[model samples]
Target chain A: MRPLFVSGLCIASALGAGLEESFAALRNGTSGLRPNDFEPFPHPTWIGRVDGLESAPVTGALARFDCRNNRLAQLALAQDGFEQAVARARERHGAARIAVLLGTTTSGILETELAYRRSAETERLLAARDYAATHGMFSLAEFVRARLGLEGPAATVSNACASSAKVFAQAARLIEAGICDAAVVGGVDSLCLTTLYGFRSLELLSAEPCRPCDERRDGLSIGEAGGFALLEKAPGAKAAAALLGYGESSDGYHMSSPHPGGAGALLAMSDALARAGVRPGEVDYVNLHGTGTPANDRAEDAAVHALFGAATPASSTKGWTGHTLGAAGIVEAAISVLCLERGFLPGTLNTGRPDPALRSRVVLESEQRPLSRVLSNSFGFGGNNCSLLFGRAG
Target chain B: MMRVFLHGVGVVGPGLENWAACREVVSGRAPWGEAALRVPVPAMLPLTERRRCNAASRLALAAAEDAIGAGDWPAVGLATVFASADGDGAVTHALCQSFAAREPEVSPTQFHNSVHNAPAGYWGIATRSARPSTSLAADQDSFAAGLFEAALQATLEPGPVLLVAFDLPLPHPLALMRPRRHGLAVALLLGREPRGGALAALALRLEPEAMASPLPPALEALGDNPTARALPLLALLARGEQGEVRLGAVGARQLVARCEQ
Candidate 1:
């Protein structure tokens, strides 16, 4: 597979907006999980909620697309001059030649949830909501493409946590097949009641900041984030990293639970390596999905151990940004890019003691190290798994 | 332009039981009639798993099963692309209603079924396939977007690709927001190379300012559903004729699909 350069990228998460903020937070070992303050139905769990979405609704011509999720996307797109980069790409490849593929589990369902609440409270007819622009799964892509003035093919992937990670793979395919000369690939997942109580319903919410791979790790700290990257067939002079490969697979076991043996996770990792023609030893780091759930962490640990054997330095950055669900893939991929450019390796935050039973060398602190290739994992509900490999552009 | 061989097809919609049963109507050889969409359990699903699947999942699985079965292809290794306009309408309605009623006790099963890829996940379990699968949405253009994605994948990969598009009506109250007149699911087994039993060879190209052909009045009611956007292409195939129809719009361009037999 030909490597697609990450010419432009930006991220907004609990860490903050833009690459600089997130980079500062990550380097300073800041944790973004805060006590549940979200209204309507605030469960007793910490979350990586993005600030300012409430005061900042998408306005103007695209006002109908306004929603917490779309707001996050808007906020992220505004950062790091990503829109400007896209404008340049639009000039390089006609707007219709750049596809937009995004991922999100719950697109603006919060708008629907709020509508339902308001309708019940007022005892009136449910006000008509712009379902397509607001709550539809395609809303994210539609909003982004419209906002960025891109006219190329656009679609939204919604396979749970693996959603965003899979977008990179699709972008690669579309570009490789010449359907699009370039692609804007990423994901945006905002804090919403659906995931809050939904995770609660599954009893997978952690009361504290999620401590991934910790011996006493309980469950995940839900987070909200949005990030994007411009993928081009060739790297620009200033390009810092390239997408070496991406692999996707399904765990045929259970909808919520991962394969106990991490069969699918291993396959995704192996496939990414095989596609990039990179040996396991060549990967400088592994970013585990590491949701902090006992089962999720253990399964990932097993898979990492099976493949890289305790040698590769790996950690979960969830402590700084919780589990961003559908956005996890791109957010982490952005983090990997930062790691490549800054010559640093981020360690698992919020974990004091790594689980002794886990075989992988789970790093506990951020360290400055020159890194080349990195593999990031994002597994989603319904047993969807994706692993992405990024490296310094040659 | 990108090309893929369509080896098999499956469809379920109002009054249409399966591809074989409705070819005459789709081909305009017979008048279409309205009937309830009866989503059958895919034979591949286990009893316990059947009970766990929601309507949308069952609809997609049923169509996928039909397509795989018709092609006589082993389901274990084929990559898949599942697309829908609205995913799991029932679950969304339930969750929203539960929260609105202040009874926010979301059933765990419903929570798991809420994911857009629930159908793909269930299909993987039923077929025990670990092959790559994606679930996507493009609003009213979901079918077209799906077809493009699947064809591109089939062209790039070595094996056959299964494309499934499905959608069901949103329950009342929520239905007021976005209403669908019917439920529909369509599947196509696409391959890079023409197979012995190939139904047709499709050449998909994106064209600017292209207008999608309107559905025949006989099949017009099915048009209310996004997945039914595949009807035009299916209708062309049903006639066993070489023809072209616009699948739907992606962005600024519409996907024009030309079929060669």
Candidate 2:
């Protein structure tokens, strides 16, 4: 099968908007995480939050459906010549021929939750408009589709952290099946009390910026981000990056923790390579699903070592991005594509001393290297693991 | 494009616990269960593993077990796609409450259960199958979407594909959104028809006819007891309902079921 090239790609993350801003932060090894600033939180926890959301402006139609999450998406979509790319796609394929697939865990549910709490009548916690927009997981996708004026298939993938990464797979299948000629695949998630408290309850939230693959790594710092890519079927098209292949697997070993042996992780990596028809040696770098949790880091480390050997350069951008949860997949995938486009691998910040167990297999700091193919990993809570492979467009 | 066939199915929801029970309920021989019970998949995993599975995962496993028992498990490059309207709501709610209490402690078990694909992952582990699996969600049309994804997967990787759709009612305040009893439905599809069984070709058609009742009874029934919809269709097949049956949503999005004798 020919590669599905990413003709245009953009990211709006905590580090800042646009390719230059985000890449500059990665190159400088700056962490986007900071003390929690979102009001309503009872206690302080580190977060990767995008500033100036409350003051962000929206038009009449977009305003009616606007919320913090969609606002984050709007900002990201406006960066890196993204709007121009959409306009070009509209001219090339017609608006109805393009599809929109977004991945998110909580789609405006935070706003709905707040509304319910403030409702005078418990029976009707949500107003009709709010209920229509925020009651379901499809709200985020609906908002984007309407905003972009996309008439083709518009859907949401909510498989936890792997949500956005799998959006690529869905979009690819849609194109391969001749359903759509082009697709916008990405994810958007915002920092909300619900996610912050939820992870805190699970003891998975760190008080400090997460140090992935480090010895003293405590837990993950939840963050918010939105990333998008324009995938076209023109195999010969000039492109920034090409999606080589993707592999997905479920360990079903546990609900929250990964299999100790990393069996499922291994399956996902191997499947992705097999689909790409590339050997492990061909992979130049791996973007790991390193959440900094004790269980997660260990399992991911084991899988990486077993698959690519210890010599393959690998790093977790989560140190800078603060584990964007559902948005992690697409965000990291976008970063991986950027690596192929820019030829510099982002370092795993905050790893002063690497975990002894990971020292042999992990890349603790950033390094520059010529990269042809990069494998990005996104593993979610339910042992749902996905590995997406990207290569420089030929 | 390869033709995908729906060979075998199993469902556990509301008043129906098995294929026979589903047939009875769909044929009006039984009333829907006021409350839902988690049905364990037969021999899909060890008893110990089964004990740890969540309600959605258990229902999916049970349905996959029935589907696989009826047909051979696709050995090479099979893909698993699981869908639900509300994914692990109880576990998500628990996670939220734990955060609200500032407990700084969460059950690793519950945290894992919160994933949408937990059931598909568990099935792969138990089967020791390394094929790629996906967990998907699309609100009330989850079943139709699952079927579409399964068909798409079959087209991409031509093998037997397993699709499971299940959702349980939320606890309290969350339940007010669309309160209903618990339900689950499972269907197994193959690129080619299995040795013995009826075959069905699934297609999607956008019709001009708007539903007289914007919300169709079939849609409501399926939403409340998704597994029950499969039983009625199967019972119709058992009773010789031929040709195609069209189930549509308000916007003319319809799933066309073509059953062959």
Identify the leading candidate in terms of TM-score: 1
Candidate 2, residue A174: how far the Cα is off, in Å? 2.2
Candidate 2 DockQ vs. native: 0.36
Give every candidate's TM-score on chain A: 0.98, 0.96
Interface RMSD for model 1 amounts to 1.5
Q: For candidate 1, report its TM-score.
A: 0.98
Local accuracy of candidate 2 as per-residue lDDT tens digits, B155-253: 676467777777776776566665656566655555555445535554444333433112223324544643333443465554555555543221124
The deviation in Å at residue B257 for candidate 2 is 3.9
List model 1 lDDT by residue over A191-234, tens digit each: 88889989999989998899999999999999999999999996
lDDT of 1 at A223: 95
Candidate 2 lDDT over A204-242, as tens digits, reads 878888989889998999999998988998832479799
lDDT of each: 0.90, 0.73
Residue B37, model 1: lDDT of 88
